[model samples]
Target: MGRIVRVISKDASVVCSAIDGKDIVSRIEEIHKTSAVVTAALGRLAMGTSLMGFGLKGKDDSITVKMDGDGPTGALICVSDSMGNVKAYVQNPVVELPLNDKGKLDVRGAVGSNGTLSVVKDMGLKEPYCGQVPIVSGEIAEDITNYLAVSEQVPSVCALGVLVNPDLTVNCAGGFLIQLLPFAPESAIDQIEKNINGMESVTKLICGGMTTEAIAMKALEGLEPNVLDDFEVNYRCNCSRERVENALISLGRAELEDLSKDGGTDVECHFCDKKYHFTPEEILGLIKE
Candidate 1:
């Protein structure tokens, strides 16, 4: 099971996750038959979303992370809820790109750096909060970290990792978020920088059998980290036929009439590749209500 760990130290608060998601990402690749490079790009976004999503304080609260870039990967979108459930979809899932200078997946090439990262949070309020920041790097983690620092006015260190195997399945995936509290001292910042500089790759740690808590402990060097919460996260989609039906009804009479000329309408859920069909008779029934 994939697990998200929330912890706190005297100087800071952190969220770390070691998601066992080979099966989940495999299903995603199967759904889209994403190229290895695209899979890495999408997988990193999924990991980053879960780390942010599990921070919602309410049961119905949710967060969406979206990036509109100039690259062929189109837009990357992920929706996550307070319960640690997440779903992801890409506008163009089959983007292919050459490796970067590091001989790693060229995520920045797949998702151009000259774009914007937008975050929307719904907290069961009359109006949700929205923040946008220029894509500092299309590397997922750095972009999100930059978003928090610039848009939210919070200093955060975020790292995300996704390792795609030769067969295009995710081998392991994980991430960690370290936020410096307002009252944190300068020593705390310097200490963390030293720790991070000496630390190893997070996904590699999870691959080598380290738990999320251990990673959290490694992040907080001088301060003692206390595990506050632990829960399972998943690539879960809440889409259903009822939601599709409601959406169809929202199209109004004119749109429904035009759709009826085509005999039927086929709508596919972006989050999950589920397709829903509505016949002309159904459209007529929906418009009447």
Candidate 2:
């Protein structure tokens, strides 16, 4: 299980959230069989979504983040519940590219820049809240920061990272989100900026045995931070046979009848690749309901 720690400055002018998501990313990589670059890209998105979802006020609230880019990866999608459980998938898990000039995995090249980053928040309301912004860097972190600052009108700094081993296993994965609340003083903002500027990369800090709480403290070093909450999170797929059946029912009687002609059908979840089979009789039964 991964852990998340949320903190607020003593003056309540800023909030910082951090996650150590190695286990979550490892489970996702195992399920998706993603290439190095894709793992890094999706992992970063999942962690960022988890951090964002932690801010939801309702127990049942959830957030979905989607990146539709022109790169080979196609689209990367991550969903997180208020409790921090996350599930994610990429349109092309096998897509890979050569290392970039930085001699690192070319995440930006794989994610592409020509696209949009969209977020939807479901708070059990009549209509969910939606926001969208053009992809800024396709580097995941920068794009998330851009979305927060532009669409959400929150000045935030986001940093996400994933380190994949030579054998394609996750070594460490995590991220941090620091947001300046409205009416925040200039001194608080400057202190937060200085703290972030002097800190190491998230992955490096995790690799050095720093916990999420420590990361939050580092980001708010001079701000007298206080821990608000700490909790565990995981890459959890909520898909079930019942949910699949409900989805199939939503296709309408005509569609159900057509599907029943085939004797049976199989549905696979995009997030977890779990397959559910339904017999023709079952399909017809759903039609009667």
The prediction achieving the highest TM-score against the true structure is 2
Q: Please list the residue runs of candidate 1 whose C-alpha ends up more than 4 Å from where it truly belongs after superposition.
A: 11-23
How many clashes does the backbone of model 1 have?
Answer: 0
Q: How many residue pairs clash in each candidate?
A: 0, 0
* TM-score list, all predictions: 0.94, 0.98
For every candidate, C-alpha RMSD to the true structure in Å: 1.8, 1.0
lDDT tens readout by residue for model 2, 7-43: 9999999999999999999988999999999999999
For residue 154, give model 1's deviation from the true position in Å: 1.4
Per-model CA lDDT versus the true structure? 0.81, 0.94
What's the TM for model 1? Answer: 0.94
Residue 92, model 2: lDDT of 95
